[model samples]
Target: EEKIPGVYGIDTRALTKLLREKGSLLGKITFEGGEDIEFHDPNQENLIAKVSTKEIVEYGSGDKTVVLVDCGTKYNIIRCLLRLGVKVVFVPWDYDFTQMEYDGLFISNGPGSPEFAEITVEHIRKAMEIGKPICGICMGNQLLCKAAGAKVYKLKYGHRSHNQPVRLVGTEKCYITSQNHGFAVDNSTIPSEWEPHFINMNDGTNEGIRHKTKPFFSAQFHPEASSGPKDTEFIFEEFVNLL
Candidate 1:
């Protein structure tokens, strides 16, 4: 707001905005492509740019679900998962899964090559060793594919927007989805232990996978989409059912 300036960021937990009603503060906050968050900060010069760009624990915990997170997908993605009766925990890319504990795990949406996730892969291997219900999306999908003995190749320019055509593996039905990623799972290297469930109709890329014998599975698109099509919203129901 021109009349007021506030703190803004891609992390939309609403803490900075709520703190703005003090009137003595000037805050101009905006979460990645989201609305502008403005208020007032009198003491500082240009308060909007100085509102501590650091990440202030955007995640919370609950008894219902647990999730692994990255820099992409933003906080809105987590909100959707929470609304579905899931309590999520943000696991970084390098934490040893064997050290920590949680319930069903959700590999979150993110950008970058899946190979960049050495820690996630290690923890995933451990989860599979014990048979956990895991779900991966976007980069999460690529990580699962690679962790289960598949290879990931960087796409030139990558798929960074919404509206992708995905087909159910057996049904041959198409579901348009919101996608954002720069890499894809190489089907040729997918291990027999992981069963590919969905395929991208446009590029023939691996869009989803499930373990043949484990309760874990994943999709390459966002079912928790902020405002995208709801064609795959049932995936959330299926995930809770699997849990």
Candidate 2:
């Protein structure tokens, strides 16, 4: 009798090393009998449509209304916003929310490459046209960069740990942060109107960006820190203050 083949285990340590050296790439797994199956790259598709909230969802009853572009937003992002005494209205990633009255615009975290979320990028560009205070997290950061004419690229091994350290730009202050993403904004591509706000201490990668005189900013880390440290929880407070 022939034995069936299956994965016994994965060498995560070696995989991590390889990813670090080669950056993120498109690949696939196949069984011996399924060797002819094709591998499709999810990054090339419109990921926002699959991940965004179809219907508008509201939370909290604070005076300020924050229009949250739902790109598979994490629950903690809403939780933190509610805790800040602000009203959150979660809209689809491709929704044209310019007609809606709001105090701020927030872009949420999600999966796949930010380039695939072209509609969300356009919405952000519209928000910028209206001069709304904007804040983003995780994938949100990359989308904001795209809206600002900046470029994003896949990171080698990315920042996917809880205790990643990030230092505030032009400051000696460092904060332990929670991160989970495979792409990063290219620091060299940021326009003159914006500046690098935070940097990863371990690898010197761009961790955040901020507009020079506009109330626009974004972080690659999860400041809400659902299952991680709260060292950067003040980021939420800062966003609220911007409004």
Winner by TM-score: 2
TM-score of 1: 0.70
Q: Write the per-residue lDDT of candidate 2 for residues 129-161, one digit (tens) a residue.
A: 999899999989999999999999888767889
Which pairs clash inside model 2? none
Model 1 scores worst on lDDT over the 10 consecutive residues at 47-56
Q: Please, what are the lDDT tens digits per residue for candidate 1 over residues 1-243?
A: 476655534455465465444322234545678876675534324221222122323355455656554435456666766777766666555555455466667666664445556666877788777665788777777777777888887654355467888898878589888877656777888778777888887778888788888788888888777757778978766776666
lDDT accuracy of residue 201 in candidate 2: 96
Candidate 1: what lDDT?
0.67
Q: Clash totals for all models, in order?
A: 21, 0
The 10 consecutive residues of candidate 2 with the worst lDDT sum are 26-35
TM-score of each: 0.70, 0.89
Query: Where is model 2 more than 4 Å wrong at Cα?
Result: 1-6, 9-21, 25-29, 32-40
